[model samples]
Target: MRIPSLKLLQGFEAAARHGNFSRAADELCLSQSAISHQVQQLEQQLGQPLFRRVGRGVELTVAGEVLQQSVRRALDNLQGGLGRIAGYMDPGLVVLVCPAALAQGWLQPRLAELRRALPQLSLLLSTDESARFVDEIDVDIVIADRPLQQPDVMERRWLRDGWLMAAAPELAQRLAALPPERQPSEAGLLCLEDGFTDARAGELFRAHLAGFRRVGIYDDARLLLDAALRGEGLACLPKLLAAEALADGRLQAVAGYPAVDGAQYWLARIQGQPRAAIVAEVYAWLARQTEEA
Candidate 1:
C-alpha cells in the first residue's frame, strides 16, 4: 500500500495531457525515454495500463482518465499554495479583489486617500469578482457579499447599499418643482442596470414613475453618476457613493421620493499569516468606512 513517486505522477499527467511522451518530456525538461520510464513505473505500481499507443502519440486508458482528473486538481492546488507563499514573501504586496462596479464606483473616487494611507505599500487592485472568494489563494482582501463559512477567514460588515433618487443641483431643483403626477414622465431618468433586477434603486422608483424617460441605462453606477453630474436626469444611486458629490453641491437627493435600503457587502480577509503591512492599512480603511456607516 505504497504511493508512487511525485515524478511518476507528474510524468503520467503530462503525458496524458499532451498525448505524446516526447512533448511531455519537453515540458518537464526530461528526455522521452525518461518520461516513458516514469510512466511505466507508475503503471506497474498501480497494477494497470495507464496509456495505450495510438499512431505516434498515446491516449489515456479508463483508469488513466480517472487518475488524470485527480492529479490535475492536486497540481493546481499545490500551485495555488506556492503562489500564496510568494505573495507573503513579498513584504510590500497586498492583493485586493473586489467587484468591477464597486471598484469603479468606490475605489476610483478614493484614489487620493488610498495613496495617502499606503504611500510605501504595493497594492494589487483586482476587480475580477467572478471567482469564488475562498478559492482565491493570493488575494489578501475581498470586498464581497457572499457569505463564507470558513473559520480561518475573517469577515466584517463593509457597506450597506442605500439607494436614493438624486440629480445634479439644477436638475434636482427642477424635478422638485414639478407636480407629483408629471414628475414621472418629465424628470428624465438615468437608470442603473446590473444583474440584479433592481440595480438597487430601479425597483423602488419604478412603482411611482410609470412613464419616465430613460436618459441612459448604464451597467456601472459610476457612469450613471457621471450622467447625473452632467445634469442629465434623476438617477437611482447609492447614497454612500454620492455622499462626496452631495456634500460639495454637485448632486442633490430629490426630496419626497421613495428611497430603499439595499444589500450589504462584506469585507473578507485571511486570518492566518503571509500577512503584509499594506493589507492592514487597506483593511483599516475599509473598517473606517464601515464605521462611518
Candidate 2:
C-alpha cells in the first residue's frame, strides 16, 4: 500500500490528540475546515473513517486511535533524536569516560561540588573502559586507571589510592580467632583481577597476596567490596572505596596488614581541543577533590 502524505497524518494526529479539529487547527495555525479536509483526505487514502463528528467536536474511530498512537510515537522519536544531535554539537558539553565503580563510589557523590566549580559546563559521564584517548570517544576528559600515551593527548595523575585488606566485621572476627601466621592461609581472598594501574603494581599485589587462598576473583572494585561486605572473603581494596563502610562498622581493617600504595587514577584529554581550558579547570577541581579524598 502507498504511504499517506505527512500533512494528512499530522492533521489527524493533532486532531485525535486534542479531540477537537478546531483546537488542532489553532495549534497547527490552520483553519478548522483545512484540518477537516486533511483528515478526510487521510481517511479516503486509508479507505476508512478516521473520526466521528460529535456535535461541534470529534472523536477518533478505533482505526484512528491505533494510527494516533503510532504517529505520536514516531514524532516523539524524531524529536528526541534531533535533541541528542544538538547536544552532541554543543560546545559547553563535556563528556567523561571512567570506570563504573569509580563513578558510583567517588564521582557521583561530589557532582554538586563540580557543578558549583564549573557552572557553565555540562557533563556527560560514560562508563566505557576501552577508550584510550579523548578522540576515541566523544568525551572531553578520561578518568582511567592507566595513563594515555598518545602524542595528541595529555595525561596527569589525578588520584593515588591507599589500599588496605578489609572484611566484614563478622569475617574479621572469624579471622581473628586463627593464629597470626595461620590467618592468611585460612582466610578466603577476594581478588580483583585487573585492579592495578600498571604492571609493577599488579606484580607487587600478586606477591603480597600469594599466601592467601583465593576464593573469588572480580574485575570491578565495587563487586569485590560487595563480596567482602557479605562476609564471603577478605578483600584488598582502596581505602577511598571502603571508607564509609569502615566508618559505619560494616567493614573493618584486618590486623597486621599495612596500607599499601595502590593504583593511580589518570585524567586525560586531547592536547588541542576547543574546550582545553574547561578541561584543565575540571582537572584541577578533580585534583582538589583527590587531595581531600
Candidate 3:
C-alpha cells in the first residue's frame, strides 16, 4: 500500500480535530484555502469524502471519524514519548501552583533551600486561589485546600489543621479592660473576604462574638497582617501568617475564643505520570516546612 503525503495527512488530521479549515490552518500556520486544498487532495487520493459540510463547520464522515481517533491516539503517544525523553535528559523543569498567601509568607522564604538542594532544577511557580486545580494549566504539582477527591489526581494532606483568627496586643488589652458583657460589642473586628472565610475558615465569629463593627476586610493575608500590626484593628489572619507576629509579641491570641481548625493543605499530582525529580524534591521540602511550622 502506498503511504499518503504527510502534509495532506497532517492537514486532514488538524481539520478533523478542529472541525474547521480556518482553525486547522491556524494550527499549521497555513492559509485556510491551502488546508482545504490539502484535505481535498487527500480525499481524492483515497477516493472517499472524509468530511461533509454542515452549516458553518464540517463534520467528519465515518472514515474521517476512524482516522481522527487514530490520529488523536498517535499524537498523544508522540507527546508522551517526547515528554519522557525530555524528562530523562533534564528532569529539571518543574511547574508548581500554590496559594498566593502561602507563596508569599511561607514558601518564598524557603525557596532558597529548595534551589540549593536541587541546583539543576528549574522552578516555575503559579498562584492559584481556587481550591480546584485545573489540569489544563499543565502544572506538575498544585498546593491547595483539600477538596472532594478528583479522579486521576493523587491528594495528600500536608497540613492537618489551620484557621483564620483576629488578634492583636492592643485589641487584646482593650478586650481585657472591657466588662464581660460589653467586650464583644465594643471589640474591633477584622474580616477577610467572604470566599476565604467560606473555603478555609468556618464561620466562628458569628457564634462567639456579639455585635461588632467591621474594622476592615482585606484580600491578601500579608496586607491584613500589616493592618493588624499597625493597630488598624483586629485582623482575621491565618495562623501561618501570624505565627511570627504572635512569637514577637506584636499579636496575642484572643482568650475564651474557640480554637479555629486549620485549613488542610494538599499536594496533588496527576496520576500515572512519572514524578519529576524536582517536583518530588519540592514536595519533600514543603512537607518538612509544614512539620517545622
Candidate 4:
C-alpha cells in the first residue's frame, strides 16, 4: 500500500498525544474541524478506528498507539537529518565542540578574541562532550580527553589538567581554622554527579577525602562552580574550570586536596575542512590561551 501524506500523520500524532482534537488544533494552529478531517482521512485510508471518542476528549485504540510510536520516531529522525543538512549548507559556519566546563572556563572568557581573529566566519559552539570526534560531519574541531584516530585530523595536547578543590574565600578561611582531619567533614563537599567529571569523583573522595559529607551533587560543573561561589561547600572540579576563579581570588584553594592528574585534554581539528585559514587562526588562538593560562 502507498504511504499516507505527512500532514495527515502529523494531525493524527498531535491529536493522539493531546487526546483532545481542539487542543491539538490549537497546537497546530488549525481549526478543530480540520484536525477531525485529517484523522478521518487517516482512519478511512487504514480502514480502522484509531480513536474512541469520550465526553470531551479522545483515547487511542491499539492501532493508534502503535502508529503513534512509529510516527514519533520517524519524525524525530527526519528532523535530525534535516538539521545535519542545514549545517552542511552553511558555508561560512565553523562548528566547535567541547566539554561544558571547558567552554565555561576557557571559551567564555576568550570569545571576543576569537571573533576578532575570525571576523568573517560564523562560529557555532556545541558543549556536547560526546561530539569530540573531528570526523563527525557536524563537528569541525573538538577539545577532547583523547585524540581521534582518524588520519585526516591533527591533534595537540592543549594542557595537562586535573581536579582542584576550592571554596569561597570566607568558607576556605573557616575551613582553614579546623584541623586538617576535620576540614573536609566540617566544610562538606559539592561536586558533579557520578561519571560527569573527568575523574571518578566518588573514588577520589574515598581515597583522599574520607569522612567528607556530600552537600550537593550537580550534573553540570558550572552549577557546581556556582554552588562553591555561593559558599555552599568545598567543590572539587577540573583545574582548568576553577583556575580563573582561584586566580581572581573569588575562590580559594583548600589545602590538603591537591589536584589529581588524569584530566588532560587534546585539541583536534579536521585538516582542510571548510574555511581552513579561518579555522586555523581560531585554533591557534585557542592553543595560545592554554599556554598563557
- Give the candidate number with the greatest TM-score: 2
Model 4 alpha-carbon drift over 4 Å, by segment: 1-92, 135-137, 195-204, 272-275
- Estimate the lDDT of model 1: 0.79
Query: lDDT of each model, Cα atoms only?
Result: 0.79, 0.79, 0.72, 0.82
Clashes of each: 0, 0, 5, 0
Better model by lDDT, 1 or 3? Answer: 1
Candidate 3 residue pairs in backbone clash: 161-262, 162-261, 162-262, 162-263, 163-262
Among all windows of 10 consecutive residues in model 4, the one with the lowest summed lDDT is 194-203
The superposed Cα distance between candidate 2 and the true structure at residue 15, in angstroms, equals 1.8
- Candidate with best lDDT: 4
> lDDT tens digits, residues 1-293, model 2?
89887788888889998999999999999999999899988888999998998998899899988999999998899889999889876655778888787786667767888888888788888888886467734667888888878778877888776677888998798777876457777678887776544444465456766677878988877888899899888887777677668877999988766556766889888775536466678767876765775
Candidate 1 lDDT by residue in tens digits, 1-293 = 79788889999999999999999999999999999999999998999999999999999999999999999999999999999777656677778888665676667678688778777667778877764354334678888866655667888778887777888988788878987667776668787765138564555655665567776888877788888899888887777667678878899888876768766888878775536556777788888987765
What candidate 1 gets wrong by more than 4 Å, as runs, is 1-90, 132-137, 199-203
Which digits, one per residue and each the tens of the lDDT, describe model 3 over residues 1-293? Answer: 56687788889999998999999999999999999999889888888899999987899999999878987787788879998667545468777888777776567766788889888877777786553553523676788866537777776778654554546787778776765457657556676675244643555655654455676777776788788778776566777767667777888766555667666788776665436656666666776765775
Clashing pairs in 4: none
RMSD of each: 7.4, 4.7, 10.1, 8.0
**lDDT rank, highest first?**
4, 2, 1, 3
